[model samples]
Target: MNRKDKIALERYRKRLEFARSSGEVNAFETKAEQKARIERAKKDYAYMCKEYFPHYATSEPADCHLKAAKQTMKNPTIKKFDEMPRGFGKSVMDDILIPFWLWINDQAHYMVLVTVSKDRASELLEDLRAEFEGNPKIIHDFGEQHGHGQWEKGFFITKSGFVAKALGAGQSVRGLRVKSRRPDYIVVDDLETKELIKNPKRQDEYVKWIERDLIPTMDGDIRRFVYANNRFAPVMIQTKLQEKHPEWVVNHIKAYDPVTYKPTWHQKYHDNYYRELEKDIGTLALEAEYLQNPQVEGYYFKPEHIQYGKMPKLNQFKIIIGTWDVAYAGSATSDYNAIDVKGLHDKNFWVIDTFVKRCKMVTAVSYMCDFQKRLPKTVVVHWRFEAQFWNDEVERVIRETERQYGIKLNILKIQVPKIKKMDRILTLHPYYQNGRIFYNEKLKSHNDTQVGIAQLLSIEPNYKTNDDYPDTQQTGIALLEPYNTQNDGLNYRQGKMRPKNERI
Candidate 1:
């Protein structure tokens, strides 16, 4: 069918369904039962959420969600900014449940929903509209809710005299009112996009807009201004607000603890699920979206530092080592298995190949074994990973691969240095800066190589995201340490050694 027909059909069906809803009287809860429910909902936001929208609020609310709800509801004059991990239903709680909760309790007479754009705001408004117009529980509890204003575009008013308007960022929002009751409750959701974060001027403009224009639109002594979004970058509006207004209630919560790799909502997220997600979306994205730590851009290390050129002959290399940086978790930690095969010649470190992936131990072990088989029998490779990661799991994977391939790898555990990771990764900067490191030009476009290079370039002091690639590369250089030393032939700075006794 055409677009108009489909839309008309949808509207007609909604009307028919609304007409049929009364016949589903058996499905509706009794007035007293609903009254009791409303009382309970007034007291607890989470309960109202699950009871009203069973389809959306599937699992028990996480502490972050509950905390956000409490913070939003407890203070009527709250100017709160919540930074929740994406996919954790920040919108459902901030935009819909809490606002509806206030309306139901007669706490808010006018509400405003602001998003990144007017269209986006309208979409969220539609969700609230769906609950009002079609939700049986809402209809049963609050009589009918749709009416009082044009539900066109981005404006709506319930029959019970609650006003709501959706607006985009940077739009004029001063002097908004509904019969002497201006917007007492305002929610700003997903106002920072990836593009907006890149422009510092734009980010500053947004923060300015919120502080100067949008928040001023609300009336009365008791006003609610909520800004909810998962921080997408280091210098977004949320961070700007955090710096300027430390007094505002800032509820910053990640989907999982970065150190323990524990999910905030333990009942919903698990290790296996995160593993698949890490594989599907990559570590950088997971760190940003799920872990609330966006990837750090390189300050010391630059892309130009990595030179792609012709590799020297293998026979010309003084020493070769295939270094591995292993993580304990199969998929949980912000660690990937990085296998960097490197060679040193004439003070230059040549990165021959790389195997970087967030995968099972068996997969990384299999790659090591396969790569070993491809090398000529004359070439000997010294395989090494950190001695700290020497465990039954790593041993079992290597032994099983040995059995499968009928070939033993000359793998050994290397002692980890007492130095910090950030310091060690930075040690490679001089080599890169001096034009002494050559990446195999043929592997320049390879996924593993590119990913490894990206990590290398992302190195800076106290970087929180993955660093396994550069860690392995630096370890490989350490392994070839013996090849790097030079003998200084008899330079006579001590020709004065005899002069010391003479001077005395």
Candidate 2:
């Protein structure tokens, strides 16, 4: 039968079934009644398709180059495509691809389109509506008045199936669900932000949403789309899903790649701009933006700027203090504590050595004992430990170790005034700038220590992280800041005094 004939027959069968269920028809029904029933059935079927499968009107195979690449269906269980950066074609893919497929196939299909924000999702849907309304073929085939929702427009049909909705990142996307069998397509487009991509916590949250909410909604037949800018996240949702489901066909398109797989003219333009930027701004900013390389460490605060090459052999300063920021215990969940030993050498304060460890209290005490053995016998003064978070057991262990080793340990029970973490780091900047403070070369070895320090100085006040080392360093600096004033007039104790006349 021809397409029109098949449509008419299907409409008649639906009407007859409805009439039987409704008890509105007898074996002696009039010809006019039978005709009206068929017309109503046809209209109902058209309405159902319009509501749930509006994308069918906008999305056609010929419109998207990426969709054309994956038109064949051996399993219909998997669908995948990768499209490079073009104009607004990516938005077209988001709006139309799955809806068009479902419309022509006339199957019960579920679709989800996700982006980085709700506004983006709505924008795509609006574009889809515009495309559908403008297409004469779709209006002629599916009828013009088939869509709904003034704020959130969607096409629905009563019988053929339902087209669920689109969503963006966050809690809004997590709540999307369909009562239907399985979603026909799930599209995630640029779901991560720059800050979130750099954050481990946010990245993990995104992954959890996929595993808990997204994966359960899939069935034997699933079409998934992931489109995003390549940012360096430890484990993004796209990366995690690809790892878990190896059968998934993955496609990656860099911003620079042409539609035809060669480098685009825009890429060449970007290259030229980057070269000019490199010449003008130097290497640091160019590498960060264009090449996506990690910024050079110590660019903002160079270690050498605060380095004191060598101090006088003779002790000319009176006060000597070593401060400890003790850690409770070492675990993967928490950061290790940092201890900085500072002393006045030749009237200048120097941070000679730093101790960093993620160890039990006894192990840390033993490490400190070993450290004490290397210090100059006469210059060694008070070893101050911050006892704020130190439990009784750890404190006892520390006391026992100091007594056994014959070392004088001063446990400072002072409560630090609460301030923003980053603000505490900035408090040390003045000393660093004025050459009153110096750090040993070993400061760089602590993981992300400098980054945390820079972030503490530059980031907004509310920013937080596992930044114990920088905090410890700041505490020591705060304690020492007053010493510069207290010891201003004190006579320099020339211990083991080198003969002034010996130089002559």
Candidate 3:
């Protein structure tokens, strides 16, 4: 016999011996009984998955998401995207359980699983082989049954004539035929990596592969596409899929609620546990993996966008002002009162310093007075605050502070505009993007500026806590509106608009 034939014969013998040793060969049950039991389980995907993967069985209602996604994949024409958060068991379900279900139910003729890398793809295939060949639950029900000579890493076949292969992202998947049948279902899991999403060009290429090459590999009209991933970036394959086909059934299950911050599954992951994760990885990373909302650097505020260098001398600018966003509640957990001190010269604006602290209303007022006293007397400081919530109380504090400090104060009480906070925040995005805003290096050590920048980059329309820092910063930027040539009505003062000469 030829060498290849000899190797194949020896491999088959080894598999048969292994199966016999593992008690996979059923001696008592008839073929009809085994077939009947599998058919019964096939009617319910959750039961079949539980029966095979008993260790993963959970009472959490979120598991229902998996079952629903499986049903979506059962159709031949329906394409699906399951962008579940990390630790949601998406990869476990897609790589192993769903494929097993399709094979046993005779719903799919051939399937291919793709992952970020060829090594990871092969590892997932190896995991599938372990369950097929050694899992006691599957073996006990189905008996010693596997395709005799078609089992290997990265490629495998079931005794029921189901063909499975594993390939890496962007790998050659065309002309993939098993037993004269083209791939009927494609399961993609974790196809994005940090490096891939960091580059827009690479992201475009990935989208092309999915649109031009990957989806067309399906053999039949009634084919299925199951794409699952944790959104490490806002621009990912799942994001692309959702944009391309809004009609597809997309299940975006976050690990926790955005408002309550409660874990979807309390038994396994609690809010406290996620807080620890947030502390370890920072807010941006936690938002990406746990919340399934990636905060791309430079999407809103980028470190590179702001020109960072030595702070200009406070007296060098024509005007210096401070903008305040006060916390009316004055509770221990309320927003900190932030006073952003800014200097404006010609067209450039420099953040001279910052005074941010969490305190009661009286103490916050005292802190602002102390900050003003420390600045040079020649540098005119104008203060503006949101007065809609507690205007009377804030005015009283301003009067009390001026009386105690014995210094005239120019304060602007802006009636907070009736617009979305994000809409106002977005107005300052251009200044950041154009390198018009400069920050003092000392702000990082003296103030919570680093944390504030992170908060700004991660801010979303529905974001809960981060609006304060960016809101204050945006107010500081708004101080330049009088100098902007675009605001024809407001630019009457031209060069450096002085604060109204009034005593608080």
* Candidate maximizing lDDT: 1
Task: Please give the lDDT score for candidate 2.
Answer: 0.50
Q: Candidate 3 — which pairs collide?
A: 76-222, 76-223
lDDT for model 3 comes to: 0.69
* Per-residue accuracy of model 1 over 1-504 as CA lDDT, tens digit each: 999768755864564364334333336567787678789999887788777766677788888788887877789899988888877888878777888888888887887898888878876776676667777777777888878455554687888887878888899876477667788998999888888877999888888998998888776776899898887776788888888998898887778754446688886787466656766876667767887766556688887777888988777778778999886566645488889999887766899889987667787888889888888776777799999999998899899998898788879998978898887777777667667678989886676777787788677666655789999998887677557644233211231223333443
lDDT of 1 at 110: 83
TM-score, cand. 2: 0.40
Off by over 4 Å in 3: 1-40, 56-64, 67-70, 198-202, 299-301, 304-413, 416-452, 455-469, 477-504
Distance from true position, residue 143, model 2, in Å?
A: 46
What is the lDDT for 267 in model 3? 55
Per-residue alpha-carbon lDDT of candidate 2 for residues 1-504, written as tens digits (9 for 90 to 100):
999768645654553343223122244767676555444434343332233334342332222233333342233555343433433244444445444544445432666667666656654554444434444434434456334432233323223344556566654443344454556566666676666656777777777776677655666545444443342333465666667677665544333221112223341344454445446754433333333323423433455545544544424444656566676746533455566666665446666666555455666676667777666776554566655675778779878988888875655655676876666666665556656665545554433334334333333334433455567767766665556644345422222223444442
Candidate 1 lDDT for residue 144: 87
TM-score ranking from best to worst? 1, 3, 2
Compute each candidate's TM-score over C-alphas.
0.71, 0.40, 0.64
Better model by lDDT: candidate 1 vs candidate 2: 1
Clashes of each: 0, 14, 2
- Candidate 2 segments exceeding 4 Å error: 1-221, 225-308, 311-317, 403-408, 441-460, 485-504
lDDT of 3 at 235: 64
Which model, 1 or 3, shows the larger lDDT?
1
